[model samples]
Target: MTIRVLLADDQALLRATFRILIDSCDDMEVVAEATGGAEAVALARVHRPDLVLMDIRMPGTDGLAATTAICADPELSGTRVLILTPSEIDAHVAQALQAGASGFLGKDVTADALLDGIRTVAAGDSLLSPLATRVLITRFLSAPAQGAPPRASEDLGALTAREREVTAWVAEGHSNEEIGERLFVSPLTVRTHVHRAMTKLGARDRAQLVVIAYQSGLAQASRPAQR
Candidate 1:
């Protein structure tokens, strides 16, 4: 299946460049383009593309707010957002993920990496494997925003024991294959459990599941052991 993409960037040159690159891919197609955040939100609602290539900074609504709006809309729940930014600032990454972005990529990424990221996010997976991303999620996303009202997490009682285990593994940044190996199950089985967890938790995607796992303290972040 061809993955439909909506490009949202403030720079016309960058958008055109991305359009050319994405259109060259056989499995992906650019369905729409938005120059600002509000326009991105509106286009996403209208096109309901499989993914939106969102820029972090934009005029007016901005990428973070646009991501929130798109993700919050039940009609556009199936659409995923992949944040594209020039910098890998921890605070911005946390906010982007919180706003429902499935992945974050630097503008300096190679064409192949960018395409792979689009495909990865479109396939219901998150591209947060980089160490910086891990640290950002661990340190920032786990804590409640300052001065923000305390919020209650969704009940995890709806998930079975195995599903909870799978979610924790996911939050810890384990891929399906890695989780399957740990659990002595097939990758497909692990994926099934992940999907079940997401459904029960009402998560938009695997990224949201990870966010919830960390925010709810069901999983704790620790530094990766030295290789």
Candidate 2:
């Protein structure tokens, strides 16, 4: 199936460049374009594209607010947002993830990497790697929301013991392969456990799973300061 994409960037030149690259792919196509964040949210509601390629610094509304709006909309549940920015600043990454963005990509990413990210987020997985993902979780998503403490362990009651273990490993920045190797299970098994945990916790994807793992206190280890 073709992946429908909505391009949201203030620069017409960049939008055009992305459109050319996306449309050139057989499995992807640009369905719409937006010049600003508000327009992006509006077009998203109207088009309901599979993915929105969003830039953080738009003229108005901004990508973070737009992402929150889109993700919070019941009608747009099937739509996913991917933040494309010039830097992988941890603060922005954390904010975007908290706002329900499915993935983040630096603008310096190669065309192939960008296309892969679009596909990854479109397929209900996040684009963050294990290490970067860990730092994001440790530094931002793990923090208490509204100055409250992490949710009680009972909050993760829906996940099985094994699922919780897998989630903790994930929050620690282990990939499926790494987790499998550590647990003596196959990568596919690890993926299944992760997916099951995601389903039980009502997580949107792996990034959200990591967020929940930390926020719920299932993974509490801290990491060194990120550069």
Candidate 3:
């Protein structure tokens, strides 16, 4: 399936550059472009693209607020947001995740990495840059209340034991394949558990699931390994 993408960036040059790159790909295409957050949301509502390649900093509304608006809209539930920013600060990464972005990538990433990130997020997997992952683990997930309100443990009571286990691994930044390898299950089985957990907990995506895992005390954040 072709991945329909909406490019949201204030820079016209960046938008055009991305448009060219995305349109060149066989499995993906640029469906629309927006210069700021409000326009991004409007275009998103109109186009209902599979993914929005969002920039965090913009003139109005901003990408974080736009992400929140897009993710919160039930009509746009199938749409995913992938935050692309020049600054991958801790707070920005945390806020992007909280706002329901399925992925975060630094602007400096290679074209291949950006394309891969888009595909990864469109395929229903969360993609975080290495720095973003570290920030998520060491800052936000470690102190979930700082990023968002904490969920009571009973909120997690709806999840099965395996689902809870899978969620914890997800919080620790394990992909479905990695979680499956660790748990002696197939990746598809792991995805099933993830979907079940999301349905039970009312999570928007894996990123939100990670937030809930920490907030509900199903997962404890720890320092990421040094590369």
Candidate 4:
């Protein structure tokens, strides 16, 4: 299936460059282009693209505001926002996430990396530049990530030994492929374990899985600071 996308950026030249790359992909198309944040929302409403490539800085509402509006609207249920920005600053990172952006890509990312990121976000997975992702977590997505915890740690003794192993890497932000590689299992197997682990732990998405890993003492052993 073709993945329709909307491009929003203040720079007409850069927007055109990105369009060239996106249009070159057989399964991707750029359906709308907006030069400002407000127009972005309007175009998004009209086009209903599968994904939005958002710029952090724009006149008027800005990308954070536009992302919040578009993602929050039930009418645009399948649309996910991919924040495309040059800023390594954590404030915008935190804001975009709070606004419901599913992924982020640095402006200087290679063409291949950018395409991969667009695909990842469009597939309902969250992503961030490796370094920027770390920065984001340390600076903002950390403590109080999902509001106050009910206790010092949540229970996880229910998991089988193998299930516990997978949960540790999941909290470390390992993708299915990564987990598979580490454990000498197939990605499909890793996925199965993850699914079962989440069921047993009553966890949410991967991010929350990370939170659980930490709370359950799984991540504690691997804590870089503890070593």
| Most accurate candidate by lDDT | 2
Q: How much lDDT does candidate 4 score? A: 0.75
Q: List pairs with backbone clashes in candidate 2.
A: none
Q: Whose TM-score is higher: candidate 1's or candidate 2's?
A: 2
Which residue pairs of candidate 1 clash?
Answer: none
lDDT of predicted model 3: 0.83
Q: What is the lDDT of residue 102 in candidate 1?
A: 92
Question: What is the lDDT ranking, best to worst?
Answer: 2, 1, 3, 4
Q: How would you encode candidate 4's per-residue C-alpha lDDT over 1-227 as one tens digit per residue?
A: 88899999999998999999999999899999999889999999999999999998888889988988997898987888888877766577666665568767888888999888888878766674446544554455454446645224447768777887787766555678977877788999988988788777754334445545654456645442211
Task: List model 3 lDDT by residue over 1-227, tens digit each.
Answer: 99999999999998998898899999999999999999999999999999999999998789989998998899999999999877666576677787688978888878899899999899987886545554555576556545456788899888877787788777777777888888889999999999999989988778788877777777753323322
lDDT of 2 by residue, 1-227 (tens): 99999999999999999999999999999999999989999999999999999998887788888998999999999999999877775677777787789878988888999999999999998887665676665777767766556666686888887898888888887789988888889999999999999998888998888877888877864321222
Instruction: Give candidate 3's TM-score.
Output: 0.87
Query: Model 1 off-target regions past 4 Å?
Result: 130-133, 146-154, 221-227
How does each model score on TM-score?
A: 0.88, 0.92, 0.87, 0.75
Q: Rank the candidates by TM-score, best first.
A: 2, 1, 3, 4
